[model samples]
Target: MADVPALVLDFGGPVLLTPFEMAVREPEGVVRDLFLEQGPLATRQRPDPLWADLQEGRLSEREYWARKAQAWHEAGGSAPDVPVMFESLYSPPGPRMIRPQARALLADALAAGRRTAILTNDMRAFHTQDWIDGTEIIHTVDVMVDGSVEGVLKPDPELYRRLAQRLGVDFADMVFVDDQPHNIVGAEALGIPSVWLDVTDPDASFDRARTLMGLDEVVRDG
Candidate 1:
């Protein structure tokens, strides 16, 4: 670990587990189909594009949800059940922890006196109790910059800058890790180094820039 000491983490893909096939893709597909069938006008309104923008912080979640709900109502759907949809999207079949490798890396870093922090874009009201309950991972971090709490989301320079300020570290000394390429690119643009945790690729190596195969790696690398 560097003496300057700071590691910024993305919650969803790196620490909090995500069910790619079920919670993500499946729900996204279901929502898309629901929109297509009930709200044909959504095509003209471009709900998907709007959602992407919202995710990237180009639009507020409240605004996105309001517009989406209106579109669903106009399309003859029952307001698209926003809360239920989000619950389904984030509620994985089983809670998951980072793989042992990643955990080790993080542990090593922390043991070496590095500060660890999380920077994630998540809903304000979404409770993370179920995911962190009885999990040792929560204790590993020094601070958590939840987007909901910060009112700023990733892919935006504001979020990155705010986190660096809060941590009292320079952007160049901070390393951000997330599974999404766009997120990595966004952090890179702000002069923060990034690690892409591509869990989908069996042959992908996390060794490039302190990437980890799993949580164990974090402990070991740390």
Candidate 2:
């Protein structure tokens, strides 16, 4: 077993690709952001109660989005294809969504003798046991604490604590990497060091992560 100096990373945006993320960083992303974040009908990250539960893997995707579609309609937006759009956007087992930048950072971490794992809030796309272990970029890091499987998600101190316990490491011994600011805050709140991956430039993010974790292997220029 590798030394239990753990490096916990997020899957979406940071490691794996998702459509919602693509939309966020797209060339014309601001218009999409307005529709998704700033519009009158947008949830603005304030997910409805059911959607919030969905993030924690407590509710089925269908149940949560079905309710969300209703709310969108009531608010004068016609987003009836919420479920299809979500699934179709993030269809896994494809080449288009693979992100090697985060994978390379993980490989470097392992080479530096640190145990690494993936912690994600996902439902369908990332859970394929056969496919994930066989992929070149993905197979290097295997200890995954996925929300769909663990019934918890990031920004939840319980999940972070649970991961530390499962890895047999102290809270201070773990360094977390994610693309979300609030998730970073959550991890840091539990005394776990965290690295925030810049969605626009993951390479720089990993470099920043290395500095925060005091990792000195394979430094890259920003």
Candidate 3:
């Protein structure tokens, strides 16, 4: 982690907070609850086949949703009302907060003259650039390698390498943090020191990350 010139952050669980992670943290509302409310058959609904294509920018957002609805019905579940589900599931009540510790860590890295980038397996079905653009976190980011835009996702070493190249940073000197163990292994395989963050335990994850980055302890609220 020495001589870390850049920090490559994962968007979902590591940087921008996600409901999936929150479900694990709070244990009150799980993702399956939504499906259960729809119908018992809804639980059998499989992932949309066009999901990857949609994320990779190969399919239009509208087409993805239509295909997604079709996928649900095909799986014996009543298709969700797209608008209602979108607001209830994707756009929850919260304005989605970034982990406070993550924000602090990025700020510290940037203040110390380190470059920061966001590398995420994303679905750009709707306009979310506003979230990133308007957030304070964007100020620290030097590049964002989104799967939808890049047509590549994490655990694909090529995506990480391409992101590194795009940021003009050597893989060896980049510090990456992802919540997925598979992604961590993938980055490490490329000789990049990567941290596995447990988003449910953000403070502990960031503490371990600070240790990996050769940084001293920091106090930040969740």
Q: Which candidate number maximizes TM-score?
A: 3
Better of 2 and 3 by lDDT: 3
Q: 65-167 in candidate 3: lDDT tens per residue?
A: 5554454455543444444333334443233556778887888777667778988876343325554455566566888887777877777888987898888
How many collisions between residues are there in candidate 3?
A: 1
TM-score of every prediction relative to native: 0.60, 0.64, 0.65
Weakest 10 consecutive residues of candidate 1 by summed lDDT = 34-43
lDDT of 1 at 36: 45
For 73-171, candidate 1 gives per-residue lDDT tens digits of 565545455544445444442334345435655666577567788787773344455544545675568777777788877778898888887777888
* Residue 129 CA displacement from its true place in model 1, Å: 4.8
lDDT for each residue of candidate 2 in 107-149, tens digit (9 for 90 to 100)? 7778776777878776344345544554455556646677767
Candidate 1: list runs displaced more than 4 Å. 1-5, 21-95, 123-135, 202-205, 211-222
Evaluated with lDDT, which candidate comes out highest? Answer: 3
Q: Model 2: how far is 120 from its true place, Å?
A: 1.1
